[model samples]
Target: MQKFLSNKKLIFELFQFNQNFNFARNIYLNVFNKYQKESSIMKEQIKNFYLLLIILSLIALFLISCDNKNKTGTEGRTLSYYAGNWWGKASGETAEENILTINGDSSITLKIGDEIIIPSTSVTRVSDTNYIASYYNSTVNVSTKFTFNFSSDTQGKLIMEITQGSTSQSSTIDITKK
Candidate 1:
């Protein structure tokens, strides 16, 4: 009877230890599972953030390309560059006052003192900085060519050469944009 009771006591102690161990193990497993779920959520959030950044970057790039495509002609220059009223004086043998009006349609109306230059004047742009204006005089039946050299977008010099039966004369005008 004494040996049997000692054996029963040992069995009871072993069972108590096993129950404590099982309770601790259950707690550890629950904590681990909760931490794993939190980690997975954090990973998903980071991935979503990166994906949104990439999409925004691509949209910005597309907008920039569209803006560039809408721009026109050599720094987006238009006919307005040459459209204005310029006033100056004619230099050389025939010194006189000159007022030149340039239109948007490449037409130029030049006034030298009280007289307007004859034969409807028109301008032709040869390059970015060079232009030629032709003036036809109906009475004289001769065409005078004026060459313009632009020093800047706002100021330039104009030279006109008139030839009539070997009698040729030239004049220069300093022009400024108004």
Candidate 2:
């Protein structure tokens, strides 16, 4: 009877140990599965962030290249832009439809109504779009100075101020490229 009782107690202890081992294994498996799921989500987030960064970098590079190309288009400027025939109305007492010709060699001819005047002139560049044209007319024997303010390569405003024998006249002309 003592041997049987001792065997029964040993069997009960073994059964309890088995139950505890199974419970611990279940807890470990649950914790491990949760950790693995969280780690996978973190990896996906990091990958998405890197992809967005690469896309933004490419867009910035593209915009900078386009800006550089536009800057290169308007690089050099010369006096040749003023070498053309322009038709516009001049201001002041002689305000009428005028045909003006600016030659490549810096000569100027003006046709106001039926009268034509050829003025002796010299042009000096002030900046990329500004110039001073000094004119000496021997027929009227007067000196006139013109400020040529160009707004663009194809259009500009001209202001002409002349003094002749105690009389002063000024004219403003808006001209476009022919």
Candidate 3:
């Protein structure tokens, strides 16, 4: 009878241990499933973030190309654009018909009415759109300076300053490409 009771006690302990193991297994499965779901959600969020970044990068590239297309030739001014004939009338201090010619070699010729006042001479570049041509006549003790400022690809302004002894006179002319 004692042996039979011992056997029954051993069976009861085994059943209790099996129940406890089952409970622990259920808890482990639940935790694992929860973590799996959270990992899947995190992976989806990372994919979405990368997708958004690619979309924004494409939009930025498109905007930059469009901005470049809207720019005109004035933004990309070159020395060759100034090699042409310009005609205008001096209006400020002196009134006369003038023809200004810019050569391919960055030289200039100025004609006032029927006479060539300044011969072809090398011009000094002040900037991308500005130049100066200067002449001095020692016989008459006179100095002349012509300043050219190009505003666009085909339009410009010329200012002539003439100095004789201590007296100075200035004139302005609006010029157009021919």
- All models, RMSD in angstroms: 6.5, 8.0, 6.1
Return the lDDT, model 2, position 51: 100
Q: Which residue runs does candidate 3 get wrong by more than 4 Å?
A: 1-20, 23-27, 30-34, 37-41, 44-71, 76-80, 89-98, 112-132, 137-141, 149-157
Cα lDDT of all candidates, in order?
0.75, 0.74, 0.78
lDDT of 1 by residue, 114-168 (tens): 4453232365667777878777677877668888888887788889898776788
Instruction: Return the clash pairs for model 3, or none.
Output: none
Which of the two candidates, 2 or 3, achieves a greater TM-score against the reference?
Answer: 3
Native-to-model Cα distance after best TM-score fit, residue 138 in candidate 1, in Å:
2.7
lDDT of 1 at 89: 67
lDDT of 2 by residue, 1-178 (tens): 8899998998888988899988999999899988899899989999999999999999999988877653543344445457787666665545435467776765566665444444334667687688777767679788888777888767888888888988889888887776
Residue 32: error of model 3 in Å?
A: 1.2
Worst 10 residues of 2 by lDDT: 112-121
Error of 3 at 27 (Å): 6.9
Best by lDDT: 3
Q: Which pairs, if any, clash in model 2? A: none
Q: Tens-digit lDDT track for model 3 on 74-173? A: 5644445688888887565354344777766666667664444454354576777987788887888989898989898689899999999899999888
Root-mean-square deviation of Cα positions for candidate 1 versus the true structure, in angstroms: 6.5
lDDT of 3: 0.78
